[model samples]
Target: MHHDSLHALLVKEKLSLTRPRRIIFDLLLHKDPQSMQVLISRAANKVDRATIYRTIELFERLGIVHRLNIGWKYKIELSDLFVGHHHHFHCNQCGATHTLQANPMLETMIDTVAAKENFSPRSHQLEIHGLCGQCAGQPA
Candidate 1:
């Protein structure tokens, strides 16, 4: 996305484009999505942890990023790329996350469960954890 488009998104979401928030959004746009610790470490200008967390929270609310529950810790990433629906797989060793393009089986399972439990499923997120191919073959 272009800088102008991103800025428009912030405005459409009724969000202010502060320095820290812009940097964080730009980092996610250019680099791979990362955890807060990684983002903070890569920041050129020192940013408070609280500010980072707050920006993340606001971005999440605005649908600019998705806060993924990757089991051990929270992982966030850009979400506007996907058209319909998708899932993710995270490498436990290298911390790399890949978007899964298809997962009909999982969707069916969720639908079945919702029907059996008589609960309406508004939304759901799935994160599978494992070593990526490179990490799996590496010697520890």
Candidate 2:
């Protein structure tokens, strides 16, 4: 989606259309999922670390994006295109993150396990870390 559209949506959601916020949101929306470190490095300006973290926190709370607990920090990406629950796969070697379509069977299994253990499952985040296809084929 265009940055303009994203900005409009944020405005509609009663969020301030600040330059740093817009830039961060647009970058995450257009590019693949990335960790906080990578995003900071690639950002056009030397945005303060606190600023980026706070922006991400606001965006996540507003349902504009979702965070996947993976790697050293976390991976974040646009949440509009994603629906329902699903698993995420993060490559340790390449630091690439991708979403796996939600599996009803897996969801059911998790539910059953929770019930059996008498644990209240609020939510779950799963990641299979390994070398992706490209990285696995290349000489290590």
Candidate 3:
């Protein structure tokens, strides 16, 4: 997304576009979903840990980022505002996460199930967990 759009989103959300928030937001734009530790390390004391956590929480609440529950812990990533809806493939062995394009078939199935149950579906999250190529190639 463009800088203007990001700024506009902050404004619309009633959030201040502070320096730390802007820096972290820009970092997220270029990087994939990251853990709190990873984000703090990347910040390198440029932004405090509490501020980073608060910013991430605010972004998640604003629908600007997705807080993913990948079993062991939670990860944060830019939401559909920047990229379209997508799934994730998590490598259990290596602890790596890969993005997958949205699957129309799966979405249809979910919608069908919701319809069958007379439930209105707002959104859904799907994560496939397994060993990645490099991990699978290694000795078990």
Candidate 4:
């Protein structure tokens, strides 16, 4: 997303575009979902740990970022506003991951299932875990 959009979002929310926040935002932009530790490492001498955590929390609450949960652990990424809604594919053996774009058929199935269960559909996430092609191609 554009810097102007970020500034507009903050202005609309009555929040200031602080330096730390900008640093964090720039780090996340055009990036894949990654852990906070990875983000902290990338930030290096820029933003501190606590501030990054707080800013991430704020961003999550403001829909600026989406948390991808793998059981209890999670990674953060730019929200749909910045990167369209998507699922995930994980290689359990190599710990590699790939982004899966939202599929209309899959979404229709989800909506149908929710309707059957009399539940309102808000959002959903799916993670398929298995060996990636390269790993699978390798002999045991």
Top-TM-score structure, candidate number: 3
Q: Report the C-alpha displacement of residue 43, candidate 4, in angstroms.
A: 0.2
By TM-score, rank the candidates, best first. Answer: 3, 4, 1, 2
- lDDT by candidate, in order shown: 0.75, 0.76, 0.85, 0.87
Candidate 1 local lDDT, 2-28, one digit each (tens): 556657778896866778877887778
- Reference-based TM-score of each model: 0.71, 0.70, 0.91, 0.91
* Candidate 3 per-residue lDDT over residues 9-56, each given as its tens digit: 889977678899888888788566888888889998799989998899
Q: Which ten residues in a row have the lowest lDDT in candidate 3?
A: 1-10
Residue 29 of model 1, lDDT score: 77
RMSD of candidates 1 onward, in order:
3.2, 3.5, 1.5, 1.6
Q: Could you tell me the TM-score of candidate 3?
A: 0.91
> In candidate 4, what are the lDDT values of residues 5-65, reduced to their tens digit?
8888889989999999999999988877888889999998999999999999999988899
- Predicted candidate 2 versus true structure: per-residue lDDT over 23-136, tens digit per residue: 787678656678888888877465777899898888787777888777557778877443446677777787777678778899888888998999988777667787788888
Candidate 1 Cα outliers beyond 4 Å, as residue runs: 1-9, 12-14, 46-49, 80-84, 104-109
Identify the runs in model 2 with alpha carbons over 4 angstroms from their true place. 1-14, 46-50, 80-84
